[model samples]
Target: MPQPRSTRIAVIGDIHNHWNAQDHLALKSLNADLALFVGDFGNEAVEVVRQISTLDLPIATTFGNHDAWYTATPWGRKRCPYDRDKEDWVKQQMALLDHADTGYRHQDFDTVSVVGGRPFSWGGPEWRFTDFYGEWFGVHNFEESAQRIQEAANAAAHDTLIFLGHNGPTGLGKEPEDTCGKDWRPIGGDYGDPDLAAAIAAVKASGKSVPLVAFGHMHHSLRHTKEVQRTRLCIENGTVYLNAACVPRIMDTEIGTQRNFSVVTLQENQVTEVNLVWVDEGLAIASTECLYTTMKVTEHSASV
Candidate 1:
């Protein structure tokens, strides 16, 4: 008898305290062998886990800038170098983390793996530079993060997948443009690390395609952009990068608006399709396209 083939993985990005919404969608539409969350589950992290626990699939997650658990230590001290308002919101978040830990220990939830392959993974929640700007910005050292990703790739079989940090591989997906020609640069663009970019390049160069890399951090655009320079590198080496940020206001707002998440489908070691599903006026909007063919990844990729 042969081992059962891995089920298609569902990659979700940036659920900021929208646990109820995510739970509804997951119950209604999410069908994968594994569910991968790219980060930013917010204060409802444990609730999210509780909802996910109801499913039979394995749940893998990384920390976004807003995870909150990483900011406060076990003894209620600030582990990260940054400051946070632990009033109502912090207390709530810490409670959720405590619940999540208890659930894990009791075998009521799935395992939460970080970058370094440790019981908790590499890089502190404070290492991310992007978290410094109101939102969860800077956390984790990109170089070390990249190394861990590479190690995971090397160790896993052909079917193993990876969930990247909020900051994606540089040049792996589309780069958001100054569509309005305005000079309002987002916080991520300013604090984005070049070292992480190089590390991503090295991973692709290693010749083991990561299959799927999901991320958030950018909340404006829901579409994939061809502006990613590292994507070219991945194509040359063989990997697919998906930007799964689900911001619903990108289409309606002028400055920065668009809300959607990437529903990525993978089968037979290739990305079959990517759907940018947007939520508009309490309804779901979607745009589907083939990203990679049986032979090669598409060259005429779309931008956000």
Candidate 2:
């Protein structure tokens, strides 16, 4: 039997513990084949991960830097909101996810495979948490990190791949408002993961068709200027890179409470549509803003 050629993917960006029963219900109503999560599910939030674990759809997730926020550094540990010694929040969250955690790994579907970039990455040129990486992944440096990601891509059973990461790969843009650009002071520099970029090159060199790369660390709202939002979509080298970090994914509006989800449609092994959608409490699509299409970037794509 021939497999279906089209897949609708719903990306629930950096949760930061915003997930609830309503979001879960909204996801079920969307009719998406797969749900992608870019982590930051709230400082190693075990409860949030537990809720995510019960979702009834296929999923691929990569842990964000915030997943390891409290465990990565001495300062963070000192300020941990939860008791570290009594309960390992990170371990519990990972355990809840099981195979859903795709960092340095790949999850295969019928037609396409979702491969992961580095997990728990702060997304920059610098390597911040060596000890944490060494203990968990045995990856000591950027080279090893690149190798791990590339190896995962190479192991994919399918040629059509979607690379998911906590943060995007480098070289998309250098401006603070770029998808993965650094927005803090000394702002004008790439804040994407270099290892992920290396892995992408390797994957392409090995002849895999990379349709899309999705991540969420840099929020869409710009810290530099409220006049403009971050670049949420970038198309280059036969790939579509997206920043799905729609902060406060749950927002209260005049109409009612709206939940956001970045939806990407893959057809014939190509990204055909990308949109930032908002769903009302009734699970109805309240708003739809098209960000990308096979033909052209729609008017809705303008700094939205």
Q: Give the poorly placed runs of model 2, Cα more than 4 Å off.
A: 1-4, 299-304
Measured by TM-score, the strongest candidate is 2
Instruction: Name the runs in model 1 displaced over 4 angstroms.
Output: 1-7, 21-28, 43-46, 69-142, 157-163, 172-175, 178-183, 186-196, 222-237, 249-261, 278-304
lDDT of 2 at 5: 79
lDDT of each residue in 19-41, candidate 1, tens digit only: 55444453245455555565566
Best by lDDT: 2
RMSD of each: 8.8, 2.3
Listed in order, each prediction's TM-score against the native is: 0.56, 0.96
Q: What TM-score would candidate 1 get against the native?
A: 0.56
